[model samples]
Target: MRVVIALGGNALLRRGQLMSYENQLANIRTACDRLAPVAAEHELVIGHGNGPQVGLLALEGAAYTDVPAYPLDVLDAETQGMIGYLIELELGNRMPFDRPLATLLTMIEVDPRDPAFENPTKPIGPVYSQEDADQLAAEKNWVFKADGDQQRRVVPSPKPIQVFQLRQIRWLLEQGSIVICAGGGGIPTYYDEDHKLCGVEAVIDKDLASGLLAKEIGADLYVMATDADAAFVGWGTPEQKAIARAHPDTLMEQHRDEFAAGSMLPKVEAACQFARATGRRAGIGSLDGITDLVSGTGGTLISTEFDGVEYRD
Candidate 1:
């Protein structure tokens, strides 16, 4: 089976935890331990979130460099390499089969006229206390928002239109290599008047990008590993329940009023999009539930056929 897995940012670094190299690697190793078995069983393409890491890099650059820091798209590319190296090293070492593992410096195409460019909504970087966040906002002239009690830096996260490296990815999969690509929804890029590809100052949702890649590559399964064990209906409410499976139309209807924007909403939407676009199965579940998720016992699964979709009884 060909599976494309989107690893969530919280899966790499837990909420309320310090972003340290050692801690991040340890978490990745744990995630790899769960994924190594699947890698042994099928062709795998890995995608990961880089919101916190890239934000941290941007802040550091601002502190040390005399010039303005590089744009978010460039920072996304850097984190793709940075986090990809860690995952590649660990996966290569732990894989039972001696398979080729590679990370592609991926670029995803976005519309130059994307409205997201004008409104930045995606949160990136480390969480800061209100006082510190306000201080940095004044010093850096950044748009800041309060997330719960803490504040975080926000950036433009444009929608992914296409995967520029889909051909290379398909070739690599055909070669039986474990490919790691499309980090941070790929470095957002667009064509200039002369038709040259140039980076933009935005990030793309990794789940959305992974969905595009899965559809492009004709993947059989799309697995999104998040912090939560299963997607819940009536989330955070007394009647909340876990959804095992639901057809694209069914899920859309059920979550019409319940899904929160910028949270599980996009993940659910991406899974539905991939399933509908490819007529295959897509899953959303926890990193540790990989085995069960594949076995149809865990996670929320979306099916091509509306009637075939399973839901909590």
Candidate 2:
């Protein structure tokens, strides 16, 4: 079986946690411990979120360098390499099988005229107090927005149109190698008039990118490893309930109004896209629940048909 897994940012670094290399690696090792069995069982393609890491690298570069900091697209590529290396190293050490792991410096094509470029909504970097956020915004000339009790930096998150290295990724999967690609939602790029590829200043939502890749590669399963154990209906209300299994159409109709646009909405949308596009099962669940989720006991599973569907083996 083949599977594409999207790792969430908060799964690596929890909110309010100190950002440190040692800490991040430790967390990654723990995640790998839980994922080893899955990797052993399937041809895996791993994708990860880079909201905090890339922002921190950009901020540090700006602080120390005389030249302007690298653009977000460049930072996205950098984090793809950065996070991919860590995961590869840790997973290689833990796995009993000797598997070849490689990180593709992936580029995801997007419309140059995407409206998201004009309106930034994806939050990146560490949270700051309102006072600090305002001051930093003034000094750095960046757009700032309030999120919950803290302020965060917002960046353009354009939708992914295509995976540039889809063929290469497919080849790697066929060879039984665990491939880590599309980190930080891929390095965002677009075509110029001359057909040359050029980088853009936007981030692609990891979930959406993962969905596109899953569909393109014809993977049997798409798994989104998030902080929650299962996707819920009536999410925060008193009637909040977990969904064990549902068709993509059912999920869309039932939870359309309940999901927040910039949060869980993209995940659900991605799962639906993958399921509907390929007629395969897609899962949304906790990172540690991979075994249970695959076994049909954890997370919310979305299928093309809810009745008489067998779990992916």
Clashes of 2: 0
For residue 208, model 1's alpha carbon misses the true position, in angstroms, by 0.1
Q: What is the C-alpha RMSD of each candidate to the true structure, in Å?
A: 1.4, 2.6
For each candidate in turn, the TM-score is 0.96, 0.95
TM-score top scorer: 1
**lDDT per residue (tens digit) for residues 145-222 in model 2:** 777888999999999999999999988888778999999899999999999999998889999999999999988999
lDDT (CA) for every model shown?
0.88, 0.87
TM-score of 2: 0.95
Backbone N/Cα/C clashes per model = 1, 0
Q: Which ten residues in a row have the lowest lDDT in candidate 2?
A: 304-313
lDDT of 1 by residue, 1-313 (tens): 8899999997688887899998899999999999899898989999999988998889888988678788888789889999999999999998756689989999999988989878888989888999999899899888777777889888888899989998899999888899999998899999999999999988899999999999999898999999888888778888888888888887787575677677788899999999899889899999999878877788888886656445565
Residue 5 of model 2 has an lDDT of: 90
Off by over 4 Å in 2: 307-313
